[model samples]
Target: MDIVFTVLILLLAVSVSGIAIRLLPFSLPLPLVQIAIGAFLAWPALGLHVTFDPDIFMMLFIPPLLFADGWRIPKREFYMARRSILMLALGLVFMTVLAVGYFVHALVPAISLPVAFALAAVLSPTDAVALSGIVGKGKIPGRLMHILEGEALMNDASGLVALKFAIAAAMTGVFSLRDASISFVIIALGGLLVGAAVSWLFSFASTHLLNLNEEGDPAPGVVMTLLIPFAAYLIAERFELSGILAAVAAGMMMNYTSVANAGPASTRIRAGTTWSMIEFVFNGMVFILLGLQFPHILGRALLDAHETSDVQVGLLIGYIAAVAVALYAMRFVWVWLLRWFASRGATKHGVANAVPGLRTATVTTVAGVRGAVTLAGVLSLPEVLKNGAPLPGRDLAIFIASGVILVSLLVAVVTLPFLLHGWRKHKDPHAAEETLARTMAAQAAIRAIDDVHETESADLDESAAAYAADVTARVMDLYRRRLASLDDEQESRDLARRAESLEFTMKLAAMRAERKTLLALRNSRTINDETLNKLMREVDLSETALTARRK
Candidate 1:
């Protein structure tokens, strides 16, 4: 009963947070708002307290979110940005671990090198979700956003893997750079393979065994899709591979699978709606959970430090500030070097204005906001060693990690907007490609309609054939007008667009009338609720389609 009540409260909180953000006088990021709500709920008067379990949190929230990102990210962009993503996700992660690890150890002499490394490892993975929430969609340049998203997707695995080794070293008091390197390779590769294989297997089963291609309820297939990430994550972990990467791989694999495309329209619609809801609820809950934990983590740590000495509290805060700065500095330098190298190569190829810009690098650096994964990884650190002795730096590391997470988020919230102002104000880069696609698709649709018209009219009677020809012309005219609207000639495009606009107005009016009539029938009890709903849905779908095309 308690568990159920807690979940309902969380869900209600998530829903309320969504509404509350819009109601606020000033704009704020959704995650921050959710976190604030969580903190408010955790106040003593409110008495809401939820235990934070790192393992369960990671298992429940991480996989589906990562999978969704992989599925949605443009494959072409991901491939193009592969080099940069790898440089950040793999190279920068290790660099941060080594450089920042040693820096942390030096900064706090009490913390062992292994524990410091673990701290750095957890901090290495940036939160693209948080960055997106802060910046909002279409605010960032498309190419840069893709690279950042790709980096966030891949680095979670690398960072967590590093933390695993660091934890092992701390426990056993033994370390092997060579073995760790080799193991990292095997683990990462194995995870990728396992994830792709699992996705493929699901696709095969859906098509061959489940026969989802045939018309039926798509709920089963949608449910199966929901399970893929968890399955991939658990399976990869069972093999001691990188479950994060596995989940990512499974999501990316979804793009190539026929399961999404081959299914009924209802399936696609339901799956899309289901996933959207899941993403929103899960994302909100994760931040809220962070918010719930933050007050306790920060307050308790600060209180303890204060009890010892006022100086100790300041020292704790100073440690957080120093670590946060070090992370940003390391990230900035690494990103600058990567861009500088790329610029040199571009200049060699005769590309003008190829020098790296300060704004781009700074934006990239600031966008590296530590989030849920960092929190989870840091909290997952073992409290006791093999000898049953307390881990020396575990508590302090958590405090620092928590502080850094808060600081990073605060920094990004403050800095990113000013840096991104007036950035990417130019026309959409993909406009031409989109136009070309629309024109080609319109032409193909015309051809298909014409072919079908001919086949249907071949053996018909004269009157029937005449009616078929008229219907065909009407259908094909829609595509012809669409093509004209996309034409290079301004006058023709204007005329076609005007016609389309007038048609849209009429269709919208007609749909409204249909809806009004259906509602009237339902109100008068002349039509059953089911009948009204069926007709209303048709009207709604038409209006939706019409409005979408106009936009």
Candidate 2:
């Protein structure tokens, strides 16, 4: 096939597979189908194999995906889970690198400690996105899920930084702790500052120049939002800082609706749709691309190991399993220590959480699944050392890292359902909360309506005033009915469900009635076409609210 056609085919296939996953009531474990497709493509008759360009992969895919994740993570939840996030993101990362480094070196005698440490560093950062299956529904606690997300955001920088130092040590044969420590701090902190600055600049330009609610064209605002992630990554990397962190920082800082303070509903809708598509395509490509490399990695590793008596293929597989187990074992141990300290007197000093138990620890441990960063880091390893000799265990590093990733993913996929079977959480008390929220919104709208009457009707005739009062009265009636339902729930918890359903039905009926009126006015030619279109939009928005409910 022609190269362009081949690319098109691959994209279509991946998209179709994604659609299948969604359409199926019962999906297989995460990434299994994606991997299977790539594996099949590796067949000799297929005559098609995807190749790696690590730089391109990272630059093209990582920013948008990471930024999207950060943007969606609720700010309040992130802050609440800050302590646990820090422990895993930075502290556990340090321990894992140290422990797994030594373990890998012991497991594979030919692998140098520096190279082993580099592999450990690559595998240390969990992919927050990869943990989605594990954190699904009410299986995992919300706080734990948020902490995992927060941790994933920060550890990309920490793990990559550690990998940087390890790689340097392997190349130059000189490891300076003081210099590495100082550089790590500067790189991390600098990335944060750069990210925030870039975010502010984008926000300013989008709000002032682009005018997010352009009505005629929202493309400028959408385009700017797309550019911000890439710009943030490039700026941070240019400064020799942690671009991963910077991209995440930019995303977290951005208000998705920054283009307009309020009401370009279309722009908001467009931005969300665009970003969702981007994330889906980018993430799907990453896994499939990695799977395509399986042939090359395995071939090289086997070829290299086949020469040695002790470095058998079975031994390599065993080593991968061992590494995977050790990775999570270390995490479990760390979580236990944290909780132990928290339960002791450490909670008084605010260093630990006295309530963190086995459940949180288990979830945290399983959620440590390696992701695209691991692949990118490993594949980017230098092919030759400074002396122009073949880099030692470079192929092994890729194989090991890849194995760890698949194993980690597999481990979580197979176990999470069982772990989460007993984990349950009740529905949020949204009845009371949403009732209050809607009341406040209605009150604000009423005030605005009154202000419009005062300003615009004063100079008009009595007819306009009467029309205004009639409109306000109708609106207040709707608000009054909603307010009444707020205090109408039955005392019996079991009957609350039926009452809620009946209440929702009435609300839905009101929305449908408004829609009917809009259509009637349009049919009678009593409303201008433009006015009909605008009013129809308002009715549609109101109906959407009435239809929306927690599953």
Best model per TM-score: 1
> What is the lDDT for 396 in model 1?
88
lDDT of each: 0.94, 0.80
Return the top candidate by lDDT.
1
The TM-score obtained by model 1 is 0.98
Can you give the TM-score per candidate against the true fold? 0.98, 0.86
Clashing pairs in 1: none
- The CA lDDT at 44 in model 1 is 77
Error of 2 at 237 (Å): 0.8
**Candidate 2 lDDT score at position 376:** 92
Per-residue lDDT of 344-457 in model 2, one digit per residue for the tens?
Answer: 766677764466678778877887888888999888788889999887888788898988888888888888878777766656534577767876876777777678767877
Number of clashing pairs per prediction, in order: 0, 0
Candidate 1, backbone clash total? 0
